[model samples]
Target: MPELKKQSQVPSQEDFARAKSKSRQFDEIAGRVREAVLDEFRERAPISSVWLFPGQDGDLNGYVFYFATSDVADSLESGLSDEIEKALVRKSKELIGSGCSVIFDSHESVVRKCNGNYFQYLR
Candidate 1:
């Protein structure tokens, strides 16, 4: 007969502390990346928000950003990926340098759907 192994029924305080520390560390890294990207985009893009998505296998290394529409027209343009495309494409390398993949959510297709189109809205 094979011997049965047992595991802890409940996590210990040390385990909780370790988990908390890891979460804090991840948040710190993600926050830094978000701030850096937001700062960079604010200079030339209509950035509404920046986010850092945790990477694969528990690594903190993924990013996504959204655009803020100033007006309906501006929304259309921005959503069409017109205003931010140049900047995002240009800054892809720089953003990725922070150890995460970057995304620019211009909301282009979303705008297109408003116009009853489900295709890329070229500016």
Candidate 2:
């Protein structure tokens, strides 16, 4: 006889409420970061997309900015990237206060890394 597979437990109402609250918090943080980035680099960079994910502690974890193409990603100077990061850090106290990670990469790279599980910021 084949062994029976165990089923996963469904989330309780309280668990669902907690998850919804966390999602709303993340959305607020992402919106602030998105606005700052767009205001600062709208004319300078061709950003394809942006994604944010929460950390294990349910705080803003990281920001991933994707350039439209590899060429666009490669064109940025290291110092400029650093400057951009610094500017972003300054624009949002929550990001700096939470010590969030920031990454700038090509769209293809991010898609591969995230495996289609991510929240993207739409303009």
Candidate 3:
């Protein structure tokens, strides 16, 4: 009978400490990004309709920001503070291009659904 090798031991305290530090840093960065995106959304889109789906592994690891309508979505995505607009789009492209299907649902179809048409609300 062949004997199986023993599994590695749990991480040491020092290892855990290092991991905790890195986790804190990651959280700080995430908070900054969250603030930036949300602020931009509020400034450029309708307050009630804007939504920011914080990224996670299961949820496409990116946001699903939506507006009341496609027109609002487009304006938010393109007409917001130029700095924030560019940053948001760049992050989106990077996330999507990196094997994650991050989406920017403009709600164009939904807007038409409300009016019984298609692409009718874009402006």
Candidate 4:
């Protein structure tokens, strides 16, 4: 089994409900971040969404971006973890001194559970 990536935090029930209610706010912020991700992985990964991850410390650590890839395993075969992390940190820190985490997920884990992604409903 592969070691799951760190700096990633799953949303709680409250987080989900809050995100749904305030979907527009999140979408606005994420819309801008999308450019950063694309700059790094353009023509590589299809991004699903990016949203502020409200941290336990009562601050935004960074954001979580889910990929809309067909094969999570194969998509990661290049093992570009270092490059990806550097891109995220450089971009995020430039914007707000934050870093990010990329999520390799399936529809079952996200869509089936949440019905749909919040960003899709907005932008």
Error of 2 at 17 (Å): 0.8
- Candidate 1 segments exceeding 4 Å error: 1-5, 58-63, 68-98, 106-123
| Candidate numbers, best TM-score first, in rank order | 2, 1, 4, 3
Scanning candidate 2 in windows of ten residues, the lowest lDDT window is 114-123
Clashes of each: 1, 0, 0, 0
lDDT value for model 3: 0.48
lDDT of 2 by residue, 29-111 (tens): 77788678767877766666555555666444445455554634553654555665666666545553554556666666556
Candidate 4 local lDDT, 34-86, one digit each (tens)? 57766667666544444555445433444334454353454567655345556
Q: Write the per-residue lDDT of candidate 3 for residues 25-123, one digit (tens) a residue.
A: 655644555456677666655433222233454332333435445554555556553444455555544443222233344444445564533224322
Error of 4 at 66 (Å): 5.0
lDDT against the true structure, per candidate, is 0.50, 0.61, 0.48, 0.55
lDDT of 1 by residue, 25-106 (tens): 7677556656665676566555555555556644333323344334325534656434344334344335443334444454
**Clashing residue pairs, backbone N/CA/C < 3 A, model 4:** none
RMSD (Cα, Å) for all candidates, in order, is 8.6, 7.6, 9.6, 13.8
Question: Model 1: which residue pairs collide?
Answer: 79-108
lDDT of model 1 at position 3: 96
Model 2 alpha-carbon drift over 4 Å, by segment: 1-11, 57-63, 66-75, 108-123
Work out how many backbone clashes candidate 3 has. Answer: 0
Candidate 3 residue 22 C-alpha distance from true site, Å = 0.8
Q: Against the hidden true structure, what lDDT does model 4 obtain?
A: 0.55
- Candidate with top lDDT is 2
